[model samples]
Target: MKIDWKNKLTSRKFISAVTGVTIAVLAIFNVDNLTTEKVTALVSAIGLLAAYIVGEGYVDANRDK
Candidate 1:
């Protein structure tokens, strides 16, 4: 079976889940709060950028249809 990776990558839930998991792993390793926060922010920013890029690509692809 094939997976729709584009849809998964653009999903808010998937992004949130990834962020949550990242934070949890950091906490498990006793990472400092400041570093954890920074990591979380970076992950969120990257996720947003990825979602925006993928969404725009999809729109552009269908614009001429």
Candidate 2:
């Protein structure tokens, strides 16, 4: 089946997945600029993004009912 790349690119889940993967790769590289504090901040930011995604999904589901 053909996938809709444009729709996927505009999706929150897809954006999150890409962001998470990029973060993981950065952690793996142990970049000199990404210190402990920076990593902690990044984790917190990702957590907020995830929470927003879940909350938005919940709201959308409820609205559909």
Candidate 3:
């Protein structure tokens, strides 16, 4: 089925799903307290953002080249 990008982006369902995954990861995978993992979480999140941007940029950059 074709996906609806506009509605998906605007929906609270997306936010709630991401929140649920984050809660599960922190609660189940985090051995230490959430406080101790705050920095690690931030860094990981940033790294993922960087990777996503780089991948997307690579595609769009080449497409326009």
For model 3, how does the per-residue alpha-carbon lDDT over 21-63 read when each residue is reduced to its tens digit?
Answer: 6666667766567654674466456545655666676689899
Q: What C-alpha lDDT do the candidate models reach, one value each?
A: 0.96, 0.67, 0.61
Ranking by lDDT: 1, 2, 3
Best by TM-score: 1
Query: For residues 1-65, could you state the per-residue lDDT of candidate 2 as single tens digits?
Result: 99976456546677667666766777788866546457656766765666677768768989989
RMSD of 2: 5.8
- Per-model TM-score versus the true fold: 0.92, 0.47, 0.44
What lDDT tens digits, residue by residue, belong to model 1 across residues 10-30?
Answer: 799999999999999999999
Mark the 10 consecutive residues where model 2 has the least summed lDDT.
Answer: 31-40
- In lDDT terms, how accurate is model 1? 0.96
lDDT of 1 at 13: 97
Order of the predicted models by TM-score, top scorer first: 1, 2, 3
